[model samples]
Target: MNNAVTIVRVSLNDANTLLELSRKTFFDAFLSTNNPADMEAYASTAFTLPKFQFELINPNSAFYFALVDNEIAGYIKLNYVDAQTELQDPDALEIERIYVLNDFQGQQIGKQLINLAIQTAVDKNLKYIWLGVWEHNTKAIKFYRSKGFEQFGSHPFMLGSDKQTDILMKKEL
Candidate 1:
């Protein structure tokens, strides 16, 4: 694929494509490390078209897709204010999700998506950006640290019936 990647804001019209990509990337990233039943259960509820459509239209949230040569390679979801999954701090932005296709993992698309989130927070004068990374996702933790994030706390994340811990990390803008 081309090294040049572009980020585009996701709209209601793109819900189907977004849902497909979301399910694919999420499964690719975590399925092997998680129970099949738990993964399927979570995906069934989380990746539905109606769910994606609702998210796309939410005023306090935004989604963006990374395109490599016009093909969808990844996506990022940002939540602000009351829409944040945790903390709900008005001055902070929460990166609710960020995933790249397995085929595109080694590329810098993930970094570009993160930079976009940072810029968005800065543009809005937000004090910081935060996200929850699965405790076992060491690669992601390292990536966030390289971008100046530090672990603040952790919270339980329910992957279907499985209770998992997610390390909360934050970076001040």
Candidate 2:
């Protein structure tokens, strides 16, 4: 398989595809480590077509698909200002989500997406780029740390009714 990656902005027309990808990647990344009921509950609300449609049209939010060999390998979601899940700082960019399929992991796709987020922040003259990762997701935490992010705080993330804590990390531009 080819490893050449392309990042394309997601549009309203891609909502269905994005929804499916979002659900699939979310489950693929967390199902094994979480309660199935929790996963389903979260996915039911978070990965809906209607929700994605709204997000796709939000001026302060953006989505990008990471394609490899013309295949949708993964995707990223970025938010600004009030669109951010937390902080809502006008001068910061929020990485709401970034996920790759199990088959596509370890191919630098996530890295590319992170780089794009950094560049996007720089281009906007943003103060920093931030994200929330599950406190138990050490792999993701390590990845973010490697990209120059440092933990500054945490917030509650309700996955179904689990009420999980997420470590908030940020990379100042």
Candidate 3:
């Protein structure tokens, strides 16, 4: 077990670990929803094992993990998204996902991830860092706000077998 937390690029072999972390983090983040089926589907689909593995090995995408004591405490995904259909700057780098384990909540792990994403985006010469967060995720929304993210637009998202909306947030680096 390491004393200090470490963030590192994930490898294809870490797929199973990533899925497990996603499941735990999603359930923890959305405990108020109380919808097991929806949670399971999300953890297995958007954060599926195969997809996680692909991102780990993908040249165009970078997935980072916060490791504590050699165990994954949280993870973040960064990738490019075409902005042709949106108002956002085409040079913005999309932060696809950020999730922390249940027990790690409220420990500033999320902020750490955000800072990492901003640094990564800047390193790639991206103009901004963007992410889509569930409108219902008030905690996340507030966290983003505290980190200087402003609402840019809305996007459709699936939740509990129903269509929902998510707010797109952006932070200029």
Q: Top lDDT: which candidate number?
A: 1
Cα shift from native, residue 115, model 2 (Å): 0.3
Candidate 3, TM-score vs. the true structure? Answer: 0.86
Expressed as tens digits, the lDDT of each residue in 67-171 for candidate 1 is 988999999999999999889999999999999998888799999999999999999999999999999999999999999999999999999999999999999
* Residue runs of model 3 more than 4 Å from their true location after superposition: 1-3, 81-90
What TM-score does prediction 1 earn? 0.97
Summed over model 3, clashes come to 0
What lDDT tens digits, residue by residue, belong to model 3 across residues 1-173?
22467899887877887777777777877866757787666565776777667667766677789887787889988776542224445577787788888787777777888889888778878888878888888988999999999998998987667677989998988
The alpha-carbon root-mean-square deviation between model 1 and the true structure, to one decimal in Å, is 1.1
Query: For each candidate, C-alpha RMSD in Å?
Result: 1.1, 1.1, 3.0
Off by over 4 Å in 1: none
In angstroms, how far off is 164's CA in candidate 2? 1.1
Clashing pairs counted in every model: 0, 0, 0
What do the candidate models score in CA lDDT, each in turn?
0.95, 0.94, 0.78
The C-alpha local distance difference test score for the whole of candidate 1 amounts to: 0.95
Of candidates 3 and 2, the better by lDDT: 2
Model 2, runs deviating above 4 Å? none
Cα distance off (Å), candidate 2, residue 106: 0.4
